[model samples]
Every structure is written in C-alpha cells, then in structure tokens.
Target: MLKNKLATLLIYLVAVLITVTFICILADIIIHGFSQISWGYLTESPSDAGRAGGIAPIIVSTALIVFLAIIIAAPLGLATAILLTEFAQQKTIFAGFVERCLDVLASVPSIVFGLFGNAFFSLYLGLGFSILSGGLTLACMVLPILIRTAVEGLRATPDDYRFSAAALGITRTTALVHLLLPTAMPAIVAGLILGIGRAMAETAALIFTSGYVDRMPDSVFDSGRSLSIHIYDLSMNVAGGDSKAHAAALVLIVMLLIINAISMGLAKHWQKNRIISNEIII
Candidate 1:
C-alpha cells in the first residue's frame, strides 16, 4: 500500500511538471509573438528571407504539404491495419516479421527519412524538391504509427463482435466496414492526430524533401516550404527574426491543436453513433 501510494504521488508529480512546462512555453510564445500577429501578417507574403512582411505563402505551402500527406497516409494506413488485425494469423512468423518491421520503421530518425525521400522520390522518381515529395515522405513516416495504433484498436475489440456478425451471416468485409471500424474510430483518430502533429512539427524532413521555397505553391509539383521550416529559417538564418519565429511557432501549435480537436470530435461522434446503433440492434 505504501509503495503504491508513493508511485501514485510520483505519477502526479510528473504530470504536473509536464503541464507546467507546456504552459510556460506557450506563455513565452504568446508574450513575444502576439504583437507580431495581425491580419496583414497572416495574409501578406514574407520578405527579406522571413525577417520582414508576413507568412501567407509559407502558410499555404504548409497547408498543402500537410493536406497531401494526410490524404496519402490515411487510407493506406487503415487498409494495412485492417489486413494485419482482421486477416493475418496473429501467431504466424509472417505477422511477427511484419510487426518487427513496423517497429523498426517507427524508430527511424526523421532525417534519414528525409534523405531517403530526397534520393528516391525527389531524384529517382523525378518529383524534384516539391510538395509531392515531402507529402510522400511524411506519409512514410506516419504509416507505422497509424498502422500500429489501428491494429491495436481492432485487436482490442471484443471477439464477440466478430462472432455475432458471423452468426448473423454477415460477410467479413461488411462487418469490418460497418462494425469494427466504427468501434475503433477513437483509437484511429488518436493515431491520426499523433501522425499529423509529427508531420506538422517536422523541419529537417521538410527542408530536405520540400526545399525552402517560401513562395506560394501553384501545384503539388511545385517546391514549397512548411511552417516548421519557416520557423527554423527565421530563427537560424534571419537576424532579429525572433518575433516572427515565435509567431510562426504559435501558429503551428494552434494548427496542431485545431486538428487534434477536430479529429477527436469526429471520433466521438462516430463512436456515439455506433453505440446507438448497437442499442437499436439489441
């Protein structure tokens, strides 16, 4: 009892420490960056290599990269998850090998992924330093996290769900589409939020794959810059760019929060619908 109480206290202490640190960082950004944020700042294009003017073009570039990344990753990740959890024999050697591969991929450094993207997508595939290359690189980086999370979510579903569907003479595909996916929506959304957050925060990968062009991209094939890359350039290369850097960081953080919130909301809504449907069936 005493040891358990001590562990609980320790956990609470760690939680409080993390909360305080995050709050402090946010406060610092708002303090230094709030003055730099304005309608014109968000709408105008940056000048003098991000030391002057605003970040409209950079924002557009970031949005395109992130959008393309998600559009590419989500369906592929979900399909992989379904295949692993629904079709694969869990105790087989092939399943074990696949899991190991995913684990290793998840642990790889982002910079290595950047180099691979530059070598393969940018050079070999002839995508050049463009949004498409960056998006594909981020999709590769995000896949392991999303697949692992979704597989676990599917695995956590009660076997009764499958048995009931089978007993009702429902096909596997129909059951997967209507039952398991909705039940696992929350966990899938959690993975998506994590993947998006990582993609948004990445600077090195974007710099290598997307190139540091702050001009608004006219197409996915056009070279672009991500918000994280902009923040890095401003802080590292531009003199007296602290305010803009802080402002950009704040925007990035806000974008991440918004995505997380929207994902969570959708997950909850889907889960609620699933529950209501189950009740009606009963």
Candidate 2:
C-alpha cells in the first residue's frame, strides 16, 4: 500500500508540473501580445513597420494553404490506408516495403522538403513563389503524416467487422466502403485535424517556396506569405524588434487556439455521431 501510494503521488506530481508549465507559457504569450492585439491589427494589411499592420493576409494565406493541403492529402492518404488495410495481405513483402517507405518519408527532415520544393516547384517547374507552389510543397510535407495517421485509424477497426462482412458475401470494395471506412471515420478526421495544424505552423518550407510577399493573394498562382513566415519576417526584419515580434507571436498563439478549439469541437461532434452509429450497429 505504501509503495502504491508513492507511485500515485509521483504520477500526480508529474501531471501537475506539466500542467503548470503549459499554463505559464500560455500566460507569457497572452501578456506579451494583449496590448498590441486589436481588431484593426487582426484585420488590416501590412504596414511599413509591421507595428500597425493587420494579420488579415497572413490569416487568409494560412487558411488557403491548409485547405489546399487537405484537399491533396485527404484522398491520397485515405486511399492508401484503405488499400493497405483491405487489399494488402499481411504476408506480402510489397506491402511491408511500402509501409516502411512511408515511415522513412515521415522521418525525413522538414528542411530537406523545403529545399526540394524550392528546387523543383519554384525553379524547375517554373511555378515561381506562388500559393499553388507553396500549397503543393506543404501537401508533400503533410502527406506522410496524414497517411500514417489514416493507416493507424484503419487498423484500429476490429478484424471481426471485416470478417463478418466477408462472411455475408460482400465484395471487398463494398465491405470497405460500407463498414470499414465508416468505423474509422473519427480517427481519420483526427489525422486530418493534425495535418492541418502542422501545415499551419510550418515555416521553413513556406519561406523558400511561398516567398515573402506582403500583398494579399488574388490567385493561387500569386506569391504570398503564411502566418508562420509573416511572424518570422516581422521578428527578423521589422524595426524595434522584440515589441512587434512579441505582438505577432501573440496573434499566432491566439489563432492557433481558435483553430484547435474548432477542430476539437468538430471532433467531438463526429465522435458523438460515431457513438450513435456504433449503438445502431450493435
């Protein structure tokens, strides 16, 4: 009993410490950014000093990139996951090899992706530093993440469901579409949310491929900077350094919070529907 109590105490202490650290960081961000934050700053375009500039362009660009990245990553990732789970036999060497390749892709450094995007898309493909180029580059960066998460989600479904569907003489494709994908929807959505978060926060890849244009994007082929890159530029190039940087940092944090809240709300709603579906199935 004494040992158990000690273990519990240690666990609680660790949890409290982690919570405290997170709260402290959030507080620091809020304190630094609160004074500079206003509706005008959030809505206005870039100013000469970036001090009075709004983050509207950055917000819009970030959203567009994330949307495009999701559009590219979702179908491919979901298809790959479905193929691996439903079609690929466990003993197939090719399946194992493909899975390993995805792991390697996930582990590759972001800087390498940045360089590749700069070379191929920006220079070789002649897309220039445009939203499309940057979006495609970010798509590549998030592809591995989405695919892995989707695979995990697919695998999380019970084998019993697939076996039962097969026993009912359902075609493999039908079983996947009618049973497996629906069962895994929550997890797949989770992966998509994570992918969007990563794409929004990415800086290096966008820096090289997206360009540092302060103007609003009129087309997918137009050059633009995302929120992450905008913050970097403001901090490094803007006069008076720390003040504007702190303000930008604060805005970025708030935007992240807003995104997370929306994602979590959607996830919860999906999870509720999933529960209802599962109840119906049972």
Candidate 3:
C-alpha cells in the first residue's frame, strides 16, 4: 500500500511539473511577442528581408500547404486503418508487417523526410520548389500517425456493436460509414490535429520542397514560403529580426490552439448528435 501511494505521488508530481513548464514557456512567448503583433503586421508584405514586412503571404502558404497535406492523407489513412482493424485478422503476417513499417516510419527524422521530398517530389516528379511538393511531403510524414491512431480508435469499438450490426442485417459498408466512422471520429481528429501541428511547425522540410520565396504564390505550383520557414529565416539569418520572429512564433502557437479547439468542438458535437439519434431510434 505504501509503495503504491508513493508511485501515484511521483506520477502526479511529474504531471504537474510538465504542465507548469508548458505554462511558463507559453506565458513567456506571449508576454514578449504579443506586443509586436498588429493588423498591419498581419496584412502587409515583409520588407528588409522579413525585418519590416507582415506575414500575409507566409500565412496563406502555410494554410494551403497544410490543407493540401490533410486532403491527401486523411482518406488514405482512414482506408488503411479500416483494412487493418476490420478486414485483416490481428495475428496475420501482413498486418504485423504493416504495423512494423509504420513504427519505423514514425521514428524517421524530419530532415530525412525533407531530403526525400526534395529528391522525389521536387526533382523526379518535376514539381520543383513549390507548395504542392511541400504538401505531399507532409502527407507522407503524417500518414503513419493518422493510420495508427485511427486503427486504435476502431479497435476500441465494443465487439457487441459489430455483433448487433450483423444481427440487424446491416451491410458492412453501411455499418462502417454510419457507425464505425462516427464513433472513431474523435481519435481521428486528434491525430489530424497532431499532424497539422507538426506540418505547421516544420521548417527544414518546407525549405527544401516549398522554397523560401516570400511573395504571394499564384498557385500551388508556384514557389512559396511557409510561416515556419519565415520564422527561421528571421531568427537565424536576418539582423534585427528577433521581434518579428517572436510575433510569428506567437501566431503559430495561437493558430495551433485554435485548430485544437475547433476540432474538439466538432468531435463533441458529432458524438452528441450520434447519442441523440440512437436514443430517438430506441
């Protein structure tokens, strides 16, 4: 009993420490950076190599790149998750192999992915330095995360649900579309938020695939600069760029928090609606 109590205390202490550290960091950034933000800063193009211009183009590019990546990855990841959880037997060799590949892939460093994107998407695919190349590279990086999380969510569905559907003569396709997918939506959204956060924060990968052109891109095929790359350039390359960098970082953090909030809100609404529908049917 005493050992168990000590272990619980230790875990609580560690959790508190992590929370406090995050709060401190976030507070510091906001305090130092919030003052630098202004409407003009958000709407105008940068001058003096990011020392004087707003991040309008960078924000637009970031949105397009992350949106493109999710659009490409989400369907592929969902289908793969359904295959693993619904069709393939848990003990099968193919499932095991695929899981192993995902595990290895999730461990790969971002820089390596950047290099691969440059070599394949930029050069081989003739995409050149463009938002499309960056988006595709991020999709590859995000796939493992989306698939694994979705698989877990699907597997967590009570076996009774499946049995009930079978007894009701519901087709597997209908069941997956109407039941399983909705039930697992929360986990899928969580994975998506994480993937978007990573994609938004990425610097090296965008540098190679998207290029550093700060001008507003005419199309996905045009070279663009993401906010992350702009932050990096301002901080490391441009003199007197610290204030702008901090403001950019603060914007990045705020954007992530908003995405997380919106995703959770939608998930909760979905689950609540599902519950209401079931209660009515009964």
TM-score of each: 0.88, 0.88, 0.88
Off-target runs (Cα >4 Å) in candidate 2 are 1-18, 270-282
Deviating ranges (above 4 Å) for candidate 3: 1-21, 266-282
Could you report the Cα RMSD, in angstroms, for every candidate shown?
2.9, 2.7, 3.0
lDDT for predicted candidate 1 compared with the true structure: 0.89
**Total backbone collisions, model 1:** 0
- Tens-digit lDDT track for model 1 on 194-255? 88888888888877899999888999999999999999889998899888999999888888
Output the better candidate (1/2) by lDDT.
Answer: 1
Clashes of each: 0, 0, 2
Per-residue lDDT of model 2, residues 1-282, tens digit only: 999999999999999999999999888877877877788877899777566677788778888878888898889888888778777856478788878988888877888888988999999999999888888888988888888878888888899988899899999889888888887887788788888889988898888888888788998888888888877887788766556667778877776778788778977898789789889989
lDDT of each: 0.89, 0.83, 0.90
The Cα error of candidate 3 at residue 32, in Å, is 2.3
lDDT of 3 by residue, 46-72 (tens): 888998879999899999999999999
Give me the candidate number with maximum lDDT. Answer: 3
